[model samples]
Target: MAVITHDSAVRRQLRSGLICAVVSATSFGLSGPLARGLMNAGWSSASVVAVRVLVAAAVLVPIAAAQLRGDWNLLRRNASLITAYGLVAVSGTQLAYFNAVAHMEVGVALLIEYTAPIAVVGWLWLRHSQRPTVTTVVGAALGITGLILVIDLRSGLTTSWVGIAWALAAMIGAAAYFVLSAHGDGSLPGTVLAAGGLLTGGLVLLAAGAIGIVPLHATTNPVVFQDFTIAWWPPVLVLGTVTAALAYVSGIAATRLLGSRLASFTALLEVLAALTFAWTLLGEAPRPIQLLGGALILIGVIVVRRGELATPDAPDRA
Candidate 1:
């Protein structure tokens, strides 16, 4: 009876963790197409990101406030980490990704950003002086190879060297986000952390826009207003509420449960999921190679998940 009870509890936690991961991935998956839609509608990448973060923060602030009242003192203690989480993890990931997409194909940009898991593994190994097991190396290699094949980066190359540099910069920011967000101390709640991060990021972006550091020219563009319609607002709302805010909250929860390194690796599935969604929602049909690459990526993730058992007591690498 006792053994059965323990097994059941373990199973429940696993189920909850998996659900959190999937939800987080699905929400993130929505961002690519949605952002593309906004961009096509004439919004600059920076504008879109800035608005998304600020609006999402506004919505989440009330919720986070309610939960964080009694634990207000905790917030002060983890102030630095939370700020880092917001400025780096939440804002960094979104802004870098948006900037990358502006300069390169969405798929290619994602391939670079999603390499954060590999970065995470490297960070852990260097920080702790621990060698990666074969499982980790193989999983990381397979995921990267599969992502490149799926994104079909070879055909997209042009002489646009500046764009390429921006995309690489985005990759660095994305990697930083994954590493910072994986810090899982039981301080502030995930929603609070997300809300704080969004607020910080939005302020930074807004400040840059104010100083002409990040361009905000869409406001003066006549082309942007001629086609404005109420149809867009609903989708934008969903993007902010469900995809950005809720996704960040749940993703943080999953990170807390599964730990960062593993969670980061598992989240790579968002790339494949986004590809599929883009195909279905935006009519961006994927090529045959992409399908095969997606399959390989799935296989690699599975292999890594199974490998977790081999290091049952290992601390979370990220």
Candidate 2:
């Protein structure tokens, strides 16, 4: 009876983790279109990111404080990890991605950035000697191939060297996100980590702007979404609260439950979700080939899952 109960508990945890991962992906997928609207209204990418991080921090810090209660030393203890998470995962990732988009088609840039999972696998192999099983290698290959198809990179693939560099940087940042989120054994609550990370990221962006490293222009003009123009704050609010706040918190929680490798693989769903959002919210219809590509990504994720199950003793670390 105890064994059966233990199995049931594990199943429940898996189910909840999967749900959180999907929710995180969905929320994150919304950022592209919503930010695009703001950009169209004359907000610079740096400004958009800064506001998103700042607003998210503002909302989450109080909650984190409440969660921490009197145990404030968690922040001091995990300072370095939180800083890396903020600078690399949150701030650097967004900045590099937007910079890449400026120089290349969004689809192409996104495809390059989403190659982070493969980078994650490679990083684990090189740094921690956590060699992937054959199934993992095959699944990574299929996932990358499917991503290429899903983005439909047959045309408009032209990009400058600088754009490629930025995309690669974004990929590194993304890999760091998953690896750091998964490896931390500290006692900090996920909410605290998310909040602290956002605050630090926001400050970094602000400092960068102050130093004239990136242009930080912003506008209060109404944003056009699908059929009509609406108040800019509405979309920005959603971007901060839902996309950044909820997405980061839930993503960390999912990573904690699912482990880094599986969680990163599962995050491939963000591309499909982004495509779907583009179709519904921005009226960009997906090609049938893209639909097939999405299926292949799902298959690749399943393959990776099976591989991990087959190698249960393998530690998940990078």
* Leading candidate by lDDT: 2
For residues 1-318, write the lDDT of model 1, one tens digit per residue: 997997677667656766787788888888777766777767776777787778889999999889888778877887887787766776665656655666667666666667777777777678865456788678767877788888787764654455566666666666666566656556668888888888888888887778875676443222222234335566567778877888888887777666566677777778788887788667788899888888878777777665543545445534
RMSD of 2: 2.0
User: Residue 238 error for model 1, in Å?
Assistant: 1.0
Give all TM-scores, in the order shown: 0.86, 0.92
Q: In model 1, how large is the Cα lDDT of residue 158?
A: 50
Compose the digit string of candidate 2's lDDT tens values, residues 119-204: 88888778877778899878877877888889887755686889999999999999999988876664788989899999999999
- Every candidate's lDDT: 0.72, 0.85
Off by over 4 Å in 2: 1-7, 313-318
Q: How many clashes in each candidate?
A: 1, 0
TM value for model 2: 0.92
RMSD of 1: 3.7
